[model samples]
Target chain A: MAWYFSGDKAVYLQIMEEIQLRIISGFYPLGTRIPSVRDLAEEARVNPNTMQKALTELERSELVVSQRTAGKFVTCDEKRVTEIRERMSSECMEEFLSRMKKLGFTEKEASEKIGQHCAKNETDPRN
Target chain B: MNEILVCSDLCKNYGQKTALSHLELTLERGKIIGLLGPNGSGKTTLIKLIAGLLVPTYGSLTVGGNRIGVETKKIVSYLPERTYIPEWMKVKDILDFFEDFYSDFSRDRAVEMLTSLNIAVGDKIKTMSKGTKEKVQLILVMSREAELYLLDEPIAGVDPAARDYILRTIITNYNENASIIISTHLITDIEPVLDDVVMIQNGTLRIHASVDEIREKNQMSVDALFREVFRC
Candidate 1:
């Protein structure tokens, strides 16, 4: 997948966010090895040192584990993955609600609008 | 602590005009440094000094801990802003010349890069387009296993596709034991590829900081910062 940077934040931080998103979305499946720093840098059009820094941060957060000669793999811990997914979901919801609030909608009103939109889009939707 | 290049009180002059004045700079190994400035801000003069093409009027500069001379020249690979190949020479002839001139020149790496770009060995310099000639020059420079790479305006005057190719070549060829200094005014295009930026203004060093640190402090891209710093 092609990566686009916003240029306002540090490139390494943005790389970390993108890699985290890939892991949560299963684009880089759990327990699967990820691309090397050089390959990822080429794909993202960034410096390899920046890519290495991002991956090192990922390792610190326990989202990835490096096995020396075997390279790095996405965390196989289902609990940790679910926790990150929940955190991401809350962040998206909060951002959506905040934007809606700016347009004169309350939190409840925003929730109802999202439910209606999901009902229209998904074949089987919860009430 | 492994600094590959060091310059102390470096100054250069052209007749009565000062091109660079008392420039003190140290470059560590394995970094991609952006030598940035506006038109005639002494970027070219500083690079020429490092490349040993021009002598500094004052102070001292060293490459790989040795003074700029035959020993340092053997380890420093440079690409000037202009293409220097004779028009009648074929690609193979140029490759042969470099291979014979520098002990660290890699013929295999040069051939592989040329083949990948579809640059035939038999193609004469006169037959290639301007962009192609620049690419050939870059390929020849990067094919060396040198301690330092001084690329003067390597990405200027090229299409976006060609720019991407050049950046990729630089990224992939980068070794931990060497460093690359890419001099250009196109900050936005090469900002992400650079580890640090050395900004020069009015024949003096303005700022020399890491790319991420610049973004974090200014809350903007290096290109935007450059515009603000050099605003007319």
Candidate 2:
């Protein structure tokens, strides 16, 4: 899918988040070299400088590492990768739960609804 | 730090009608600057001045520390709003013309782009669709290894698909040392690809800032900001 962007946040931050998603999802596996700034910018249809800024931010956050001669690569630290994955998943859960709360559902009721939905999905032939 | 173009207190006049006034802007190398404004707002005037087509009536404008002359013209590739090529020429003929005229013109690169777009070299310009002609013109302009590209409404007359192709071509063709200035009113479509935006209003500079800074500071897209700033 094309990289999604909205008007509310900074484009570089959005790009940074997208790269983080890719790193966590193994689309760019651990220790694998990511695309160059030009390639990523072209793929995302953004300015190359903006892509460079996003990559620089990623490097600062330790999620990506730049070798001197070679290109940038995703960090190979399994613990750090797991930490980021868990953090992102938790953020998603927090947003979902807060939204559910706005709909007047308690935490327990929301979990129960999710459990029922997953059970139904598993039993369906489409699964 | 590498400023490619500088304009200081620049003014342009057409016998009492001021097309530009007291404009000061500096553009760095390696950036894609969006020159945005509504109709009659002097975007074209600024671009023309930079392209060395029209002389400024007052103040100073320079490209790469050189006055707008034969020297600057050699490094500036300009794509006017209209299709400026003769209709009678074939695509191959135009390619040859560009190759003969500009030392930086790369026939191999232009041909590669044409072949990828499935446009035949033998096709006459008059027979091609409007969008195809625009693409051909853009390809020829971009194939040049110029220091700066001044494209006036590159995507304005094309389809959405063609617009995407044009944008991609622009993104991939420019090297790190070269910069581009795309003047158009289509803000949202080109916002993502721009590093900076120079917004003009009624012959004055309204805003000159980075796209990310504008988005972060205003919490709105550059298009929304333009509407708010230029609302009638």
Interface RMSD of 2: 0.8
lDDT of 1 at A33: 100
Q: Write the per-residue lDDT of candidate 2 for residues B1-232, one digit (tens) a residue.
A: 4999999999999998999999989999999999999999999999999998899999999999999999998899999888888999999999999988899999999999999999999999999888888899999999999999999999896788888888889988968899999998888778889999999988899999999999989999999999999898
- The runs of at least 3 residues in candidate 1 whose Cα sits more than 4 Å from the true structure, single-residue gaps closed, are A123-127
* Residues A1-127, model 1: lDDT tens digits: 3378877799899999899999999999999999988899888888889899999999998999999999999999988889988988999988999999999999999999999988788866553
Worst 10 residues of 1 chain B by lDDT: B169-178
Write one digit per residue (lDDT tens) for candidate 1, span B10-66: 999999999999999999998989999999999999999999999999999998899
In order, the B-chain TM-scores come to 0.98, 0.97
Candidate 2 local lDDT, A1-127, one digit each (tens): 2366898788899999899999998999999999988788888888888889999998998999999889999999989889888998999999989999999999999999999999999999998
Residue B46, model 1, lDDT: 92
lDDT of each: 0.92, 0.92
lDDT of 2 at B192: 88
Residue B142 Cα positional deviation in candidate 1, in Å, after optimal superposition: 1.0
